[model samples]
Target: MFELILGLPLLGGMVVMGSGWGISAVMFALHAVTLLMSLQHRQSFYGSAAGIVTCLLFSVPVWGMFGHWITAALLLVSMVDRYGAGMPGSFRRS
Candidate 1:
């Protein structure tokens, strides 16, 4: 369910990219990689309802920009939250 945050825009981006939207391809890569990193950390979206909403907002097209601003801001905020929670930047599990 929460994975929709990562999936929706990703699929949409892929479709858009198929139509020759290069920017969508970039955004797709960005979200796919970040989402994979989150999974590698075993981070669950279960309690991050805010992420769902933000990502939903991110899925919507705003002024033909694909909501990159919202998604980028949420990514920064989420990274801060995870780091403050003692999740180090390294890939090693503690």
Candidate 2:
């Protein structure tokens, strides 16, 4: 599920680059939904780790403006996965 969620944006980016605007839009939407679902289930450490890595992967500046959205989505997923469970309490206290 996580793989699919991550893959969707990447696939969508590629499709959009290849000129499949309509399918790419649909894939982008699916990617966002799946990423949300993955973050919602990030009880396991692996999920959190994967989320972080995926986010970093999108930060590379080599990706053109068109692909920047993929970066945004990955970062969003990572943030939710990392802190979605309420920041583990240890770092939450003021």
Q: Highest lDDT, which number?
A: 1
By TM-score, how accurate is candidate 2?
Answer: 0.29
lDDT of 2 at 63: 37
lDDT of 2 by residue, 1-94 (tens): 3333324556544644566445434545555565677559643233334334443444332332224444445555655655564655544322
lDDT per residue as tens, model 1, 1-94: 2233333455645655566755444555555565666678787332243343444454455422334444545555665556554555644433
What TM-score goes with each of the models? Answer: 0.42, 0.29
Q: What's the lDDT for candidate 1?
A: 0.48
How many clashing pairs in candidate 2? 0
